[model samples]
Target: MKLIDLNRDGEIGANCHYIQIGSLNLVIDSGLHPKKAGRRAAPDFGPIRGVHLDLIIITHCHLDHIGSLPVLLREHPEAPVVMSTSSRMLVERMLHNSANVMVRQKEEANIPEYPLFTHEEIDRIAKRLTGIPFGQAKRIQGGKDDITIILHPAGHVAGAAGVEIHHKRRQIFLTGDVLFEDQRTLPGAKFPAGRFDTLVMETTRGITARGSEKTRLIEVNRLIDSINDTIQRGGSYLIPVFALGRQQEILSIIHDARKFRRLVDCPIFAAGLGMDLADYFDEISRKTKHVRFNRGIIKELQIKPTPRKLNPGEDPQQNGLYIISSGMMVERTPSYTLASGLVGHARNTIGFVGYCDPDTPGGELLASKPGDQFLFKACNVKTKIKARVERFDLSGHADREELLEFAVQADPRVIVLTHGENEARAWFAGQLAEKLPKTKLIDPVPLQTYQV
Candidate 1:
């Protein structure tokens, strides 16, 4: 098989891959860079420009994975897109939200090439996107070659999947942003127990070592304690989350805490696309049994929408829990704006519960020490970091050791790493070399082709 990493800048931005097995041509994931804008954010499809794509496989609905789907479909009009049934249900909503965000950015950030694809284009392309049931093998043909594709549950989010492809006597698996440990709202991954010819995996948390004592339950309790302490101290708690998965997961977790009477009696505020996605998740849970979310959680928790007109560098004084979007706390986002005000107050707390890119505002804040001056450039606010900033080990991605063990057990002939920073990938490269000495490890340079 031959493969090319289509991501332009590499380092976990714009995830796109093109590969060929026998006579088949396939592309897996067409994602936009979370920190990049305009055309540069999209994958460099120049290598596959004239190559007729036989299939486009999407692993999930996160913007970083599916944000560029419409753009890719616009270019390859005939290639059919396939994903797990749950992802199919969520993809359009996620893409529509992306288009809406791009439209807003076009006006606010003055990007003329924003709204890369319109709503109409999404509607037109929706007909070509099909959702296949998990564990069901679908035979796809290209030229004289045919391969059977099966999607396995990847427990990162509600609709995430790990792709398994069988071509002739060879088997290949691609772990797309996976988490093997279960969470409050979802179960852990259920990958097949077997060997494979090739393994492509995500090294998202490879550089971060997990402490033996910091289990999920312990982290959950610590988070609850932190929130209770913040609220008791008359300060608000902010958990910036990814709307698609992390928001829902955090809500479910908070709901559990409240049900057990472990949480303090404080008003909970949450708003944004995540609240709307709750309804979608509820429907999915009822229909597919793949997710476990209920829209009634909002009503029971008495969740309130975030106030629309929030002043920068001024505390809202809600003294409640605020769960908002832009997990990375990107500039101009609600989390970033609220963080600006909260960071200036010593009583408040900002707790992170998911992965943050180092270049993003969230990661920068995490790297800073207390009393350091932090800047909210988008809002033109600068203040001393008096607030308590904490991070919990509740990330959606799998742990480094867990991922390493999975790859080592697979015992594949070749291993390809994707969706991580240089340091993270380097750690995995070093560990895999030491553990699986003979396995060919290929970290493809962006836009370069390699035969495996």
Candidate 2:
């Protein structure tokens, strides 16, 4: 088999991979980079310009996985896109939300390539997107070669999957953003128990260690305790989360706390695309039974939409809990603005519940000292870091140990690493080399093809 990493700049952004097995050609994911803007954010598809893409398999609905689907489909019109059944229910909504965000950014940032695709285009292509059930073997033919495809529950988020491919007598597995431990809204991954000829996996949390005390329950309780302390001190707590999975999971956790009377009474504020996704999650829970989110939680919690006009460098007028998006605190996002205001006060607190790119504002702030002078450059707000900045061990990605164990157990002849930074990949490489000295490990550079 031969493969090419199409993520352009590589290391966790614009996750697109081109692979050829036998006579078939496939693209696993086509995502837009979170850091880059406009057209530059998309994966460099120059290598496959005239090449006929036989299939495009999506791992999930996250922007970093499926954001550029329409863009890719525009070029490869004949290719069929397939994902897990749960992802199918959420794909259109995710793409539609992306289109809407792009339109807003086009107007706000004055970028010409903002709305890379439109709602009408998405509507036209939605029918072509197919959903397959887990463990079901679906065969596709290309030329004289035929291969069987199976998707397994990956459990990083709802609809996320690990790809299993069988061609001739060889078997292959691709771990697409996996999480072994169950989350409040979803169960843990249930991968097939067997060996494969080749194994491809994500290394998102390779650099972080999950200490014994940082388990899910402990982190959740700590988060609640922090919120209580912040609210008792008369300040708002800002929780920056990803609009898709993190937001809904946090809501469910919060609902559980409130129901048991463990959480303090406060006005919960949430809005934007995530609130809209609650409806979709509710439907998925009923139809697919893969997730456990209920839209009714929003109403029962008396959650209100955030105030439209939030000022930077000035604490919000209403002191309550603010659940906002752009999890990494990307510049110009609602969480970024609110963070700038809340960080200058001692009473307020900014809690991060998911992974943050080290270059992003959230990561930079987490690295800073309490009294350090922090700057919110996009909003032109500079202030001392007086507020409590904390990170809960509630990341959506699986821990390094869990991932390493799975890889070792698989005992594959070839291992390919993707979806992690240089240091993270380096760590995994060293460990894999130490454990499986004879196994071939390949970390493909961006857009380069390697035979394994």
Please provide, for model 2 over 14-75, each residue's C-alpha lDDT reduced to its tens digit, 9 standing for 90 to 100: 99999999999999988999988898989988988888888999999999999999999999
lDDT per residue for candidate 1 within 36-140, as digits (tens), equals 999999999899998899999999988888899999988899999999999999999999999999999999899899999999999999999999988999999
Clashes of 2: 0
The candidate that achieves the highest lDDT relative to the unseen native structure: 1
Predicted model with the maximum TM-score: 1
C-alpha RMSD for every candidate: 0.7, 1.0
Against the reference, the lDDT scores of all candidates come to 0.93, 0.93
Worst 10 residues of 1 by lDDT: 286-295
